[model samples]
Target: MRVINFAHGDMMVWGMYLAWLLATRLGIDPYLGFVGCAAALFVVGLVVQRGLVDRIVDAPHEMQILLMLGVALVLENGALLAFGPEPQRVRSALTLSTFWLGPLFVDVARLVTFAVAVALSLALYLFLFGTDLGRTIRAAADNAYGALVIGADVRRVYAVAFGIGAACVGAAGALVSPFLPFQPSAGLAASVTSFNIVIIGGMGSLLGAFVGGLLVSVAESLGAVFLAPSLKELVSFSLLILILLFRPAGLFGRRAG
Candidate 1:
């Protein structure tokens, strides 16, 4: 999407916090909180898009980035105020479980999270390529003015795109809640990594993002095990720098004509 949502990481944290609230207070399983988390984030995305994002859609990129950065600060600080600075954990049966595949062992929670991520990604791809709403969103993203000229509801498309993106963040939060600690700034930890993946894979290309993520994951794991653990992030960051210098449009991204 062309919409620059710098607050996306914070939105993910909000989803994690909401799921934690449900799990801790309502006795609901964190795994089962995926639905609620996604729904809440979808609504939040809608409100944020309508109230803030829509106004900046046609503005300069710098203005849009600053606005979203402001939104991110508000979200982060609001989380700190409401939940305090303490880190929280969501308890689940799969938290400590493991599965073995011959000589390999995997954390069950992490495995499930991976599976859910793939499934959701596939679902999103299908929706984007197979549904009318998806086509509308694509049209708007490709050419907002042309979309308007064609009588498409550009604003509505933008709103829906934001909602879907927020829902994706919520789903990711839900998937990782069992293993990752939830805090006001926990999601921020992944912010830089997310940017690297998008840039490496090619912005606006789902398959590129997926492949870039996998490459980063493998690089991090290999670096952690073979090199100093402290150097894992450095490896990925180096990869990002290489990508930027050599393939500015990304491995899969096409250069604009």
Candidate 2:
């Protein structure tokens, strides 16, 4: 989508906080809380889209960027007020469980997270390629005016896209919460990481994103082990710069006609 969502990272933090609350207060499993968090984030995305984004869909790009930035600020500050400044860690049964496969030991939480991520990605691909609503969304993304001319409800599709995007963040938060610590402003780093991934993989290319993330992860891991841990990000960015210099459209991005 052409939409700019600066608050996306904050939304992930919000979802993490929700899952944390459930885990700590209600003794709900983190995996189970994912369901509620995803649903809530979907509603949040729709409300933000319809209430704020829709109002400025046709506005200048600068205006849209500024608006989203403002939303990001509000969300970050609101989280600070609501959740306080403390860092939270969510512990699940899966956190420490691991299995040995030959000489390789696999973390249960990481493996399950990977499985869930793969499943979601496959489902999203199917939705985009195999369903009418998904096609409508693609149409709107490719040509909003043309989609409107074809009687496609562009705004509705946009809302759905936005909601799905938010829901993804929620799912990611739930998956990572098992091992990652959560803070009110952790979204800042997440947002940066997401931007890097999108740029490296080619914006709008699902397969590219998956591959790019793997590449980045490998680079980071190697850099951390071989070089100073603090230089991992530097290594990744250096690689990104090299890639951009050669492939300006990104590894998987095709030039739009």
Candidate 3:
């Protein structure tokens, strides 16, 4: 669970493509098709974790980095071959809808996205805290050897955890498909943004990651408003630098011993 998933963004790209496929072929909207995408990516995560990551669980950090990087490259290239290089966006009726609340006009698609994201986050929180499997996962994360000694299937737990993480990514990809024009090459930027959020929030801290995402999003939006839209990323990176300088452990992250 502590493993750095460098392939995450590429995996999300696959989710996007899967949603696109469903939308075009079956006439399923991305919003509705996201469930299938999540389920598919869950399997992908399980296979990757069980077949590849398990073997290198105890390897050096560099090895883990290289392994995921390799996986990312493979996924990216695979998407390129399958989907070609052109950017794709999923079509949905909600994309054309908007509502005015108070003095603000909000896109319906984005509103739905925000609502679903919150629901997913809440569901994840409940899953991790209120369920037996969730407790076991937390235990395994805290002390794998202890969990193993207690007869818990640590490997399976890890696999499931990875699967759930991947599923979340897939759902996210599908949710954004209506608005974000994506191609295989887009994975790099997505990965970079993800890394920025994680680092800014603090590694191994879920709350940090959540808050970090909000902060980063707000920063980017503000950047787009005040600066050149193309320079929004520059604002994100600048915030990352400031966070790294002032709170390397992240605002909510605990200092490592």
Best by lDDT: 3
The residue pairs found clashing in candidate 3 are none
TM-score, every prediction: 0.95, 0.95, 0.97
- Model 2: how far is 20 from its true place, Å? 0.5
Per-residue accuracy of model 2 over 87-171 as CA lDDT, tens digit each: 9889898999999999999999988988888888898889988999988987888789999999998889999999988988888
Task: Report the C-alpha lDDT of model 1 over 7-63, residue by residue, as the tens digit.
Answer: 888888888888888888987776788888999999989999989988977788888
Local lDDT at 54 for model 3: 98
Q: Quantify all predictions' global Cα lDDT against the true fold.
A: 0.85, 0.86, 0.92
What is the descending lDDT order?
3, 2, 1
Q: Which regions of candidate 2 fall more than 4 Å away from where they truly are?
A: none
Q: Please identify model 1 stretches exceeding 4 Å from their true place.
A: none
Q: Between candidates 2 and 3, which one is better according to lDDT?
A: 3
Candidate 2 accuracy as lDDT:
0.86
Candidate whose TM-score is highest: 3
* Candidate 2: Cα lDDT at 83: 90
